[model samples]
Target chain A: MATLDIKVLGPGCRNCVTLDKATRAAVAELGLDASIEKVEDYAQIASYNIMSTPGLVIDGTVVSSGRVPSPSEIKDLLLAAQA
Target chain B: MSLVDTLPSSKGKLALVGAGALALWGLAYWVNEWLWDWVMYGVLKLDSANRVVETVHFFVYDFLKIMLLLAGIIFVITFLRSYMSVERTRALLGGKRSGVGNVLAAGLGVITPFCSCSAVPAFIGFVAAGVPVGVTMSFLIASPLVNEIAIGLLLTLFGWQITLLYVVSGLAIAIVAGWVIGKFKPERWVEKFVFETKLHGEAIDPSRGLTIKQRVGIASGEVSTIIRKTWPYLVVGIGLGAIIHGWVPESFFTSVAGKDNLFAVPLVVLLGVPLYSNAAGILPLVESLYGAGLPIGTLLAFMMSVVALSLPELILLKRVLKPQLLGIFVGVTATGIILVGYLFNAIIP
Candidate 1:
């Protein structure tokens, strides 16, 4: 299995932290080989063209911006990407 | 590195922080009163008859006082903001019924500390977390209108009585307006993308397990950012207020918008809808109007409309909401504000 690349983008606000946790849980539950990186710089976050924070990026594609998805929902997203 | 490594170990350093805050408070008071007196009356030698001079004095004094207040309030609130994250709020409101959710969301809105412009992210987060749209609306409406910064400024300028009344009524409006919207079942009005977008990643709560040093650093950054963004509006609002204070005849406003005028409440609300201003930017104008003998009801209505029914916020909401839902949102909020205005006027006057 190929390792997955995941990025959580925000200024370290509470919602962003929740997104980070949920993502970690989803990855672990699926036993996926993935590396999670957090990007907090405003310029870097803006480069993604996301006006809202707590954004998520997987495999170079923007999947979500401005909301925290639950672990189960995140699991479906990871499975789809794996396929 | 361990978090404890960053902790301040010296008692002297802690005492220095306390002393610094006291010094700043004294300086702020001096700037608010003595500086205005020295510059406007002692140096300028301008009498009340000189409308231009008086207006200039009003502008300078209010500008300084409000800026000082903004810095202090924003710093403290931003520090508190680090404690209350959007995800935390989502967890609180998620999976609740509309009635309970609306109340809880509105209450949380007062403490969460996001401005109207930044509310979208939280709104989206709430929606994705399965929070009802109506509950989310309550949070959005209450966040901007009932924030502590605005309330602190209001208390400084208008006294605690008026401030408390504003807070109670504002929250009531947010709660009722949101509850009514929830009943409308406007879920279809949300953009398809809001529901469809899925994020995949390891979510870490950035505010979790932070040291005091880190929290303070974050708060100071917030103070600078908020002040930079809001200063221009504050200047413009105070400038307009000075003009009104110095030039406009008391009789003029009283005749038009006084308590006797039944149409004043709705009329002011209509006038306020098109203008975009935050509470800090608008309260100075409200003070000048009150000074000019504008009825309390009309002034309150105008302030609410300016903060709560701002056109810029409406345009921002348009991104996520269809026109129909947006229309309902505006209609319901405006009506609630107008009623509050009338009710206050009847009771007080």
Candidate 2:
């Protein structure tokens, strides 16, 4: 199976920190082989076309933006991506 | 049937719990002042004439009231606002012209769930999608200036009339300032890369197809996030209010910022421009000043300027906007706030 490539895009605000922490927790819980990267550059972030911070991208497909989804929600999204 | 089995469903159970929580919140808010009075004076035998007791009483009462207000209002507003998103707002403003577009943009800005951190990307996205610069400006201006937290504080502290005036004036400023900026051919002043940068990948619409449970969950999370972030400021602000209420004379500000002073409005706005704090954090001070005999117009102007024209936001916007446009944005918005302040001072008895 291909490794899951996930990206969390934010400029490191509180919400961004929360999202990053939640994502890591979800990854640890699932024990998935995922490479989670933090993207903070404006140009790189703009490329995602998200108008809000703390965007979640799984395998290059933007899944959520503007809010921190819970660790369980992240687990569900990651599980679905794996399947 | 068991009590759990007799319940309609998970959705029904969630609704029941939500309603029960809201009712409890209402009861607590209703009895908050009385409860504090009982504990401070009735039970502890603290004399009302004593400044220390009075200050402590004021702090406890206001802290509970404001916290309750923040939690309840933030939850409901966040829940309702879950239905709106910047993507949808952009779609609405796409292909819109200046006058009408500015109005719509300002109105939508109040409802849209946006954060200042995303202001640059949102600006790029909105402009890239053909939304006019002026309309986008109106949205940006209105988003932070006329937020739910500000509205909640205003309504609770100053009553609905002042709150209504604040909201109306905020929207007016956003619309007019945006229109004025629009007439200046702002496109050229934008950083060259903004126009050149092409957005990649499909924009995800997070606002779409959200279930009630999901919305509730999101709202609860938002409530916690906002409260957690703003609590320190809230404590400092309320503490200042208590100090002012107990230690300072009622006429302390009258000599400086009284209605008789013509410079008070502009001066307050200028002082407020550089300071950055959320409306919730600033309102306690504003309320204290107002109680100390500062005019409503000056206080409102101060609050608006603090929330609307922060140094950090201007610095962030400097990335996308050349110095010239940023200057104009600040100048025009500050002028509008000044005018509103003076007008309200002269008119509101």
lDDT of 2 at B228: 84
The most accurate candidate by DockQ is: 2
Tens-digit per-residue lDDT, B77-146, candidate 2: 8999999999999989988999999999999999999988789989988988888888899999999989
Model 1 misplaced stretches (Cα beyond 4 Å): A1-83, B1-15, B39-51, B199-203
Candidate models: Cα lDDT each:
0.76, 0.88
Listing every candidate in turn, what is its Cα RMSD in Å to the true structure after a full C-alpha superposition? Answer: 8.5, 3.2
Fnat values, candidates in order? 0.04, 0.75
In terms of lDDT, model 2 sits at: 0.88
Question: Docking quality tier of candidate 2?
Answer: medium
Per-candidate DockQ values are 0.07, 0.58
* Residue-level lDDT for B252 in candidate 1: 89
